[model samples]
Target: MLIFVLQTLAEILAGGTSLTSTKQIDFGHPIDRREEATEPILNVYVYDLRESKQLQHSGRQFERNKTGSMQTANVSWPPTWIDVSLLLTAWDKTTLGEHHLLAEALTILLRHRSLREEFLVPELRGHGNLSMTVAIEPAIEISSLWSALTIPLRAALFLTVTVPFEAQTVPKSLVWDRIVSIRNKCLPGSDVMTITKRVAIAGIVKNAVTNLPLTDTTISVVGTEITALSSEEGLFFIEDLHFGNYVVRIDCPNYLPQTVNFLVESQTYVIKEVLLTPV
Candidate 1:
């Protein structure tokens, strides 16, 4: 994904300016020796990459079905967003030529604050809308960056591109449509009667001491596989239950598991609040 982003940026600059194609734009370490034949070239180097903490999610596993149908998928974190830093430099035999190339490159980069979908590569296409920011580094930092590269300080454009790291997915169980039926039986003497009942349970889970909303906490119907995970706000719900006695269990890391017994009568909805003590 990182390489594809860099190549996309190079392509954008190449097409927008007099630089015909990506061939004129090279990707390598600036410290490497430049060939005389490849003079007046553009060099793109990736300097750093880090995951975006703001977009991080706690879940690590995801599930999806191969055939498209009415199926439920346990998708973990969709994809981790990462920030990649790139350095673009113009290398030439003459200072004038170098400045000329740099000027063209800067003009192209400045024209578009973000790379659009039309400019993305084949591998990146249809993933989603992705945009990259193009900006110049401060003059004071340029010296340190070049020093780190162990090369003489030269004019360069610093580019920061945000891209997604693909997540791992596994095939899970398939879901099928559910059907329910009710039949009425009448005795020889009198009248027919019908009965209908439904129940829904909703609740919030929190830390006992901190009272902070605990996300990814699993709440399940005791003897049944039906379960729901608490959201970031610590809210969870289990619906479409028949009236009966049930024991619900809550399990979360670093917290003592809890089980609550409740009897559902003719009520349509039931609300409960749970606080888990730290183990």
Candidate 2:
């Protein structure tokens, strides 16, 4: 989950139209990364992680399905909110170049307040607990951090991301697979008459004017928590859907939101191409 958070955060920064696709995002110790750097880069270092003191809670959280069946995913123990602190520094050949990159990144960070469900992996989805704050003051001594890394203190942004830490990582698909495997074989005169199958909604998001793929666009089922983010090529696939009609909404940073209605009966339903006009 920690690694997913970092990767998603990087995608938000360097992917899509956020930054010029050429800018590289590197993670690890700044000193080590600096020596290996071959081009201008954004160095992200996760400096600290601790359970959030303000949002503490105990016990389990629960939810129910449309059929009144208890959703096992939500029936697990309550998650502990962990605060992840990241140190973001821009590395470039020239000081002016690095400063310009930082300013651009600052603008992007200020626009986002939460890690949307569209960006989270399957196991970490459902809960809207991955939140972010940028330009926060460092909890640790900045000078000490620089000294420990054996690098000079430089301009950097301290980003804090509060994430839910689950006691166990359970993929909902795996849970269903285990249950189905128990009833793997169906003999003659068997009571099993239905076989459950996972369904998907797949499509591409494109710029209305440029006709180019738009990455990081949110693809959400209007009435459900199901969501998926468009990939680098602008393709998105929301899986685990059952047989039903769905209302999907597409959203991106600068584009106007779009809504489309479609029916799903096949294992994979391809949504018509979506075009979003700039606002």
Best by TM-score: 1
Q: What is the C-alpha lDDT profile of model 2 across 161-250, one tens digit per residue?
A: 888777753323311211111111213453532323233566778888987779999988999898889866676766565556789999
TM-score per candidate, chains pooled = 0.52, 0.51
* Residue-level lDDT tens digits of model 1 in 114-147: 6667778877776555656667783237777788
For model 1, state the Cα shift of residue 211 in Å.
61
Clashes of 1: 0
